[model samples]
Target: MNPIIELRHISKTYYLGKLDVPVLHDVSLSIMPGEFVAIMGHSGSGKSTLLNILGLLDKPSGGEYLLAGKEVSRLSDDELAGLRNKFMGFVFQQFNLLPRMTARENVILPLVYADNKTNAPDELTLLERVGLKERVNHKPNELSGGQQQRVAIARALINNPLLILADEPTGNLDTKSTAEIIGILKELNNAGITIVMVTHEPDLTEAADRTITVKDGVIVSDVSSGKQRTLAAAGSDGSMAAGFLTHNLLKLQRVRDYFQQAMRSLISNKTRSFLSILGVLIGVTSLIAMMALGQGAQEEVKKNISSLGSNLLFIHPAAGHQGGVALEAGAVTQISLQDVDAIRERVPGVARVTPYASGRGQVVYNGKNWNTRIDGTSADFPVIRDARVTEGRFFTDAEATSRAKVAVIGKTVQRELFGDRDPVGEFIKIKRIDFQVIGVLPAKGSSGWRDEDDKIIIPVNTAMYRLLGKENVDTVDVQVTDYNAMDDVSDRINKLFAVM
Candidate 1:
């Protein structure tokens, strides 16, 4: 039979700043399968470190640890955790049960991490085994020291692990509770579970099959039972396979048992859980509220820019930098209607194309006159510029092609010339050319550069022939389908212009 735990010259060192503090030094130990072993030592004798290494909770600095014939250091963190959950269980002197969980809930908590996909062990049944059936629903604080330790024992056995590591199992108990704990451990050993306990008391070691005394990180004495009690195992090939099948089936019983335990704890301590959840809710709510406000502000800015035709790549002449300074974009015009049509046909991300021209003009309506900028644009102007008609409707493509003397007046123009009177369907004189005001545009306040609202829009043909008397288009504003590829498409458009 292979040894359950085999350690050869295991050593551990922890660093406190620059100083190297050694715990275990050249410590060699072996414990057979199914034997109760007690590791005894004084305080600061590195007993806890040895227990940690044995339990796979701490790694040895220099040594080989073979757990059931497989080296431990080779396993990854998750794999080690799985193996610990599957094969080994722990019991502490503090009886570390969650204060909110009942006795049965605490006992069955390990099955959650055990990955018992189905058919987990019955929590109530395990509590019964530890003589806590009557106190199964009791919480940790409600139980006495001995009953709490019993609950701990039930928990250790819940996973059906091959070995148990009890760190000072009865240290905190009174005399009667300590005796009770020791007896329960003895009963478990008699029933064939291997238990390794850490203690300094002689009375505790009396129950163990073997006792190993350590002083200053080195073993001073080792007394064994000399093959007295061997592990109760299914040695026969058929029986061992059957035993494993049974364990696996039992593992299937408690599926996600840990989550259920957590839910029960939360339900049990409703007030604390509610407070915690409420704090998180308020934090997330405030975050969302602030984010919504920020998003609204961003949209307002985008709306303003869209009013000036956002998502637009102006295909006008690129002004040469004068005195190491680049002039305002689209300030000078060399592009034409032919360039706008070419881009709409060839460019991939282009959504729409608008060939536009702009010039200064004076307009009069109702005997009131105002000086404003005149813009002649295509039918897609309102869509691309995100400008909504406040009254009447924008000029249609047919009307623009027919060179109709129709115009869309802005808020500032309406305020100056119409002055609270309806401007739509009124006749306005631009450059002494009488044009009918077909619609009124929503307000766009002035920026530091210019007054955006003091402008009028008309058909390109009408502006060229009847108003400004220009034949060629100055700017071609192209809208795109995707903003991510905006720069690439603009560069491509530039390359096409270079070829032209």
Candidate 2:
């Protein structure tokens, strides 16, 4: 009989960091067609390594391997994969079924990688052979341990390969399931399919036609059942025989095999893949939401500031000023109404001017007390501050001259004092003075920690004489008619103040 598979002087070594360890040493073996062989070995006896070498799952560090009389050791990676796929199939100790796919889908997996003109048979035939005909659509988790292994075995035979490489196929089964699997293997061997199984079970070892024991990187014994079958050798048919595919087709086949394996892995470990995608989803969502909010805020700011219609500028007297004059230490008075009049008359393009004093204090009304911001201003306060009255009305020119005690409360004051009730006729106290809430200003949320709406507006003359006793306004707000002439207006205001 001729050998169907051969390993000559095969030695495989691996590196653990900088340390080299040898697993198989000068191992040589051969298997004839239609033979049932069992490889027996203790753990770490290089049995798995040898099985890997035979299955072409791992390349040996040194050796020559031949499959069907062709030198596979000299073949490239792609060539090796093609040869393995065409003539060999594998059954793992754990069954290695994809959890997301059904039993019938698992059985068809080998055919997806095999290059053949033949189509896969109906799911019924495969399921019937494995005794899983009634459970063809069941996923791996839905089936028992034994049923899953049977599906795995059906997958191994799907491509009609000449050899089956099973690593501890019955390791995870019960006595009944073990006997069932062993019987299936026997039936396959009887049908001209050669099998190479790795196991320590004496019953499984005895069932094979031959048993080879491995120990410490070498074959310890090789016992035969005294039965052998013939194998055909390659001839000049102008095309390579079985297990011999062209290099390009081999590469394409290997690429397909790799992707298929990757897909299987991802499906089997669903939680791991889901966790990885979750991390990416969170990062992408946060990044997009923040960018959108920032862009919206930027657009709103541009719109509001531009609507003010430029030409507006503010002038502050020197520190500790009252009127418009730059104050000196211990000086009695500084900025006064004269400064407001001066800017209106002398500044180029000057339209109107308003000067004001403001601060925070406690106010009381109707036996309730609350802290409120107070603003004292002229009749031009709304125009200078860019505030609008939503109801009622702003102070009239007569109210400014008479130093009226009437007041307009902001939107926040309305909410705090009246809740949902209308505050138009309500009364609130400001620094021991009773004032009427004439109107409510439109709300402007928070601007640099200051609640712009939580305040009351009163005539500046009243705030100075009736309550605060302040002699001068510290700042002057100027509104000009010609925005394009702002620079000239500011220069003229400076020139007019230079005389004092």
Candidate 3:
């Protein structure tokens, strides 16, 4: 019969700063498929290190280790983790149960990282076998030392592992608890699960089928029971393919179990969880806000450059201050239609000019009322501002000169007042005055907190005289004929405005 595990000339050494500490020297061993082996040693012996290497938890400095006929050193870290989860189970002396989780949750925790759970044993049955059925919902603090160790044993059996590794599992328990743990381990061995235990107590070896004694980093004696049977004599197969199934099942159950465990922990410890979550949120929010601000600044600059049109310059009144406090823009000086016309006629390199004003008003059409922004501009506004009319023609220059009540609406305004219906040739009331919708502006998306496509445009003369009742316009837009003459044109326009 082939051995389940084999190690040839394994050596382990630890380097502490500049000194070399040799733990194990040229050790070799073999463990069969159904043997309950006990490794005994003194305080300074290397029994624990050997057990760790045998369990695949540690690597030897120089050795060839084989587990079920497969080389161990050639596996990647992820593959090793999957193999460990599927094949071997570990039990420590401290009974490492998550304090916040119940007994059942602790027993089923191994399934969270398992690669193949189709052959997983029933969790409730395992718990009941360990005499923890009634106390399955209790936490670790509510159970005694023996009961907690029983839960750990049940956890070890959850995956139906081929090998169980126990490192001083009953070291902290009393005499009675130790007896009970030993009896349970013997029962498991009789049921054909290979177990390897590292202990210093000599009486525990009587329950095991084999005992190996180590002293000062070397094995002194290896004694086995005379009644031990090989795999062939026991009528069992030791091949890996015949033993375990590799089908993956219950993948989503792993995630759900993790989420439920997290929620339970958070609900149990309210203050710590709140502080932890708040800290994470603040950190993530700050990171995202910084990234957004940087990207938004770049995007905004690009959008503004594109929207300005070729060789275009915008002129606006400078803000004023009173009592050392800043005042609203256009508070001190406002541009008028006369100023716009003067710039257009006298300014050199000027290609096009448009007067602009803006205000907010309530718009009503067919019993639906919405409040929106209103902009007043000339016919050349679309050319200088790079705005396109999608539905109909913009108001003509003659319409602006005659102060005709005509309007063009943006996409958002169109949607709010008229759903899918055409708005051209329809009349809407703005500030209790009727205006004909002559065109629809294309969508412009949003800018910061404001929707750019939620406004209406009308003629500058009509807005200043009939709708808004203002004498002066808000700003002026100028487009130059040549790109290189922009600076000179801006200087001349500033000089002309200063003297006017």
Candidate 4:
């Protein structure tokens, strides 16, 4: 029969930039079944690297390694993890226990990552087998160093792995604890399980079946267990049965158990767990606030754009030229109400027409004086401008044509002049003109550096003839029903105005 582990001409080299650092060179070794081997070496003898390679935790740069008649050097990362979890168990000198979990819970973690079968031996039973039955419910923090190592040993044997790799298992223990650990290893080896240990103490090797000393990455001497290998071969004709609890399939029933373990870990490590959860809460809150701000900004932009109406154009007086000097727009030429009426009646896509003229003025209410905007527009101002009167009513066509001096104040003007008092049916001064406050425009908020709700609206004829003493209007705000027809209507309006 072949040995359980075989290493042939193993070599390892590490690359540091452009230089190569060689560690091991041309080493061949073999380990048989049921053998308790102890590897000893000085500090920098590459024993740890050899142990890592032998345990399949790492691969050699150049070598062939066979485990149970199968070469596993070139396996993928996941395949190596599966093989390591299935056939091999690891024990370290530090006794890496999850500080939050009880001893029994820690012992069952290997099975969680392996073929966790429902019929496998109980976790408490494994702890009992390691002489930790009384300490099954106690955590690592509550146990002594020897007790912790015992827990680690119980965990190692949970999967019933074929090989046990113990790296300096007695490194951190007292003399009594170290002796107890060695006794456990000897007891395990006698029960048909194979063990390979790495230790620096020579006295610990007395219990091992064989002692191998390594020097400078090469095996200098090896002492066997004194068992002869020359014997008659026994013939077996029948094929062996395939294993059911293998590394292939996993159980879904253990998922809840694993989750419970996670919760227990969090509960045990209170400070670290709180910090982690707080980080998640802050991250989620920041994301939600940022999303709300982005959505609000987007809605604000769309609202401002929609308030101006869709595809509408403001028809202003064309600029005038005099003595080769270009005057500002509306300085020499003016648009009359006739053009506004014609565009409203003749333009195909024109939805509403409102003549506009405005100037700054001071308004006084209840002895409180404030400077504000005064807009002079027709009654169609609400339709063309998307303005809403939340308090009172807009001026009528009959009231606008008669230049009744009715006014609609913005929300900002309402707050500044009225001070929470109802201003509807009240009169305010515009350039010392007594204009009655008829309605209040809906709050439009701010847009970039401009306040949309700080103005007043009045009749176009009132502003053109009565307030400013101007005979013509400044601009005509036109609303359109169809966006696609805007270009055609704009061209026709320009041509008609040129002739008029």
Candidate 5:
């Protein structure tokens, strides 16, 4: 019969800041199937390190390890973890039961990590077999030290592991609890479950079918009971080593199990869980709000830039200076209506040209009155400035040539004077002069600290000669037919104005 575990010339060395500390040296051992082996050693004897290597928990620095006729070092880390979960069961001295789970929940914990749990034994029956039937609902803290160890044994049996590795299982239990745990382990061994226990106490070795003693990282003695069963005799029906060589790959089911486990832990610790959830919510909300604010600001800047009109340029007279002292803007040279007409006729790639002038005025309609900005331009103002006339129509070229008393009201002026009523064709008095309202402009919202819709529109000739009484316009707005011809048109306009 082949040995279930084989180790030949195993060595372990740990590095501590350039210092090599040797734990095991040239250790060789083998254990057949269905054997309860006890490894005994003193403190710092390297016995625990050997047990760790045997359980596949740690790798040896030298030599080979074979478990169930397969090389251990050939498998990847994930495959090794799957193999450990499927075939090896561990019992720690501290019980290692999740403090938040009941005994039954802790017993079924290994099934959560197992890729295939179709053949897993019933956790309740395992608990009953370990004499914890009445304490299955109790938590680790609620149970006695011996009862906790019994729960750990039940957990080890949940996956029906091929080998059980106990690391000082009774190290913390009282004398009575130790006896109970040892008896339960002997019963498990007798029932054909292979168990290898590591203990420093000599009395615990009596319960094992074989005892192996180690001193100074080397085996000093190995004594076995003649009644130990081999692999063929123990698994006569061939169930003991069935599927032992197969590798279990990770599956998606484990993700759900992990989330369930996390939710259980959170439910168990309410205050800490609430605080953690609150902190995450606050951080996520702050990130979303900052992103939204930045996006909104970016969109607003684009809107304002587009509102200024596309492919358009403004021609303003430079400020005058005398004796190195700067004077007010447009004090030296003023843009007149003739200059606007010249640009429209002579400038190449000129799509539209309009003279623009602005002033403050008090507009009175019926009993309502509002002080607002007044702008005067030609009919091409809407097309050049991208201002849509939502109602009525702009003043025609003939109206501006004749200096007619016709005006277009913006949304704010309409709201203050008309109040939901149509102001089209109604006469409003601007600076006490009766002007007919011809149209209404669409809402333009706010730009900077001023409302773009809080204004009125009139013909340039009427504004300069009739309303505001100015000699020349404030600026000239020019729109180019194509973007590429802007530089040449600008040069020609500069040359024309430079000569003028």
Candidate 6:
């Protein structure tokens, strides 16, 4: 008889860096229609890999594979996928059901992917056929290991495939569940579905019309079992008794197959499987840490900024204009220390004022230097910005009064200059100007496009006359005396800067 499936000189090789390791060496086999065959092998004997190749889950490195008398190895990818979908079903040891989907959805997924031209079977009929009519709506996690495997079997049969390739389909089930699964396979086999299973259990081989034993990547035995006495003796029982007897026998067979495939996968790549998990572990850890920090800092900033007073007003640079009003060249220099002083003196609703000047510059320590931010502000700057001192102290009024060459460094600056040691009282030069580090501010984390904690702050006067020598402040921020007066204070400041 012509075989339903045939393998010719099939060899599968996998690459480990530059070395080629052969798993299946020149393997050739054939299976006739309506046949129940099991391939038995020890761990690393290439049983599962050959099954994968035969099932089209993987392609062989070099060889010919034929299914239903059609050459599969030379077929294009889409053509192979089409053939596999139409005629083959795979039952894996782990069940491989989608955890989030109900049993019915899991079974229906293959049909959805396989056939697009016709309406597929609904949950009720498919579930009833698989004996899962009562548990159709339950998810894989909600069911026992046996039920999940049963669902896998249902999915396999849903396609009405000619061949079933089961790779250890009952590895995690109790004996009772194993029996139920094996019973289902026997019934399908009786219905004329050709099954090619790889199992380790000797009991499973008893149900097979043909058993092929493999060791060290070579077939050791390919033999047909004479009609067993037990199968023949079943005819003496009533029809129901005979049916139940055949069902129970096949259940033990499936359990054996499940363990055989699992042992092979586990022992064959002991290091690879274990090491693969480490990558997932590190990825999960880093992902969780990043999420926690981002969420925690966002909440902290929202709380801190909210407490700083709702009346606080911030100014961001506008390339065009405010309220969609375009400005002339340098028109926005409208914001200055003059505006800061005016807001403090003219607006009764304004509480405090601070001028902020910031741009990028370089910092030098010993012979090693780093590019960093340069910001110039006064003592009231921290008060207006609502910044807290993490260490040492903020610059004093006396330091701002004399235009002192003292500065406060942020977390990153301290790390770059002093490593783990304190940076306070240490002198560092920025833009060729030597200045003592008065304090180290706490890391405030990232905000928008800026790292607020990566800056080095100096007195506004020293920045104006000595380092930056800028004519006008880039932005001016003011705190209103009361939250209700915020709008009025802002209106007053806007008018004061209108002529600039």
lDDT of 6 by residue, 450-478 (tens): 77678988888778778887777776677
lDDT by residue (1-500, candidate 5, tens digit) is 66778898999999999999999999999887788999999999998999999888889999888786677855667667777888889999999999889999999998888877888989999999988889889999999999999999999988888789999999999999999999998888777778999999998998888899999999999998666454323443334334543544556798889899999999999999999999999999999999999999999998888777878878998899999999988899878888888889987889999888889999999889999999989988888888879999988999989999999999999999999998899999999999999999988899879999999999989999998989889988889988888888889999999888
Q: What is candidate 4's CA lDDT for residue 274?
A: 96
Clashing pairs in 2: 322-335, 322-472, 323-334, 323-335, 323-336, 324-335, 324-336
Candidate 4's residue-wise lDDT over 421-498, tens digit each? 999999998888899988999888887886889888899889878887877888888877888888888998888787
* Cα error, candidate 4, residue 499 (Å): 23
RMSD of 1: 7.1
Better structure of 1 and 5 per TM-score: 5
Per-residue alpha-carbon lDDT of candidate 2 for residues 53-168, written as tens digits (9 for 90 to 100): 98888888888987767667766787777777667778888999988888988888766556672654565686798789899999999998889999998888876677899999
Model 5 pairs whose backbones collide = none
**142-162: candidate 1 lDDT, tens digit per residue:** 999889999998888887777
Ranking by lDDT: 5, 3, 4, 1, 2, 6
Q: Rank candidates by TM-score, best first.
A: 5, 1, 4, 3, 2, 6
Pick by lDDT: which candidate is best?
A: 5
lDDT of 3 by residue, 339-403 (tens): 99999999989999988888999999999888999999999988888887999879999999999
In the order shown, the candidates' Cα RMSDs to the true structure are 7.1, 11.5, 10.9, 7.6, 6.6, 20.2
Model 3: per-residue Cα lDDT at residue 225: 69
Stretches of candidate 3 off by over 4 Å are 229-253, 288-500
Of 2 and 5, the candidate ahead on TM-score is 5
TM-score of each predicted structure versus truth = 0.64, 0.52, 0.56, 0.62, 0.67, 0.46
Please report, in order, the local distance difference test score of every candidate based on alpha carbons: 0.82, 0.79, 0.86, 0.83, 0.88, 0.75
For candidate 3, report its TM-score: 0.56
Give the candidate number with the greatest TM-score.
Answer: 5
